[model samples]
Target: MHELGIVFSAIDTLEEVGREGSLSSISSVTLELGEVSGVVDSYLLDCWRWAADRSDLLRGSELLIKAAPAVSVCDACGRTYPTVEHGRVCPYCQSADTELLTGRQIEILEVVAT
Candidate 1:
């Protein structure tokens, strides 16, 4: 799955960060996940556990994910609402003229070193 690729990419990035900072080991990593990013948490974690253990700096490191809510802004009403609930339609104005404001990102927010 793509989760393995994502995990590998994250680990590569973490390795670069570690090398830049001369870190011996990483204890944890906190990641921010968008609600509509389409990455499954269980798959990500499983991939993380498998791939991270293969890295010297990331073996046993914890991967913590925080969910970010999906938001959409309505052009007709100039209001923001949850994208998951109402989808492309604006709840207040019942208009389809809406754009996604957030919830399509995956970012690493924090890293703890040992």
Candidate 2:
């Protein structure tokens, strides 16, 4: 799955960050995952457990996931609503003219070094 590749990318980034900061080991990493990001949290966690142990900087590290809700703004109603609940259509005015404001992102927020 693409989740493995995603985990690899995060590991690479964390490794670089660890080296830059002169960290010997990382205890945990906080990741912000969007509700509609399409990347499964369970899959990512499983991949992290597998991959992190291979890296010298990330062995036994915890992956903390913070869920971010998908939000969309409706042009017709000038209001924002949960994208997953209402989708492209605005619940307020039933308008199809809507824009996604947030969500669909996988971001690393912080890392704890030990």
State candidate 1's TM-score: 0.96
The CA lDDT of each predicted structure is: 0.96, 0.96
**Model 1 Cα lDDT, one tens digit per residue, 26-93:** 99999899999999999999999999999999999999999999999999989999999999999999
How far off is residue 103 in model 2, in Å? Answer: 0.8
Give lDDT tens digits, candidate 2, residues 20-100: 999999999999999998998899999999999999999999999999999999999899999999999999999999999
How many pairs of residues collide in model 1?
Answer: 0
lDDT of 1: 0.96
Give the clash total for candidate 2.
Answer: 0
**How far is each candidate from the true structure, as Cα RMSD in Å?**
0.8, 0.8
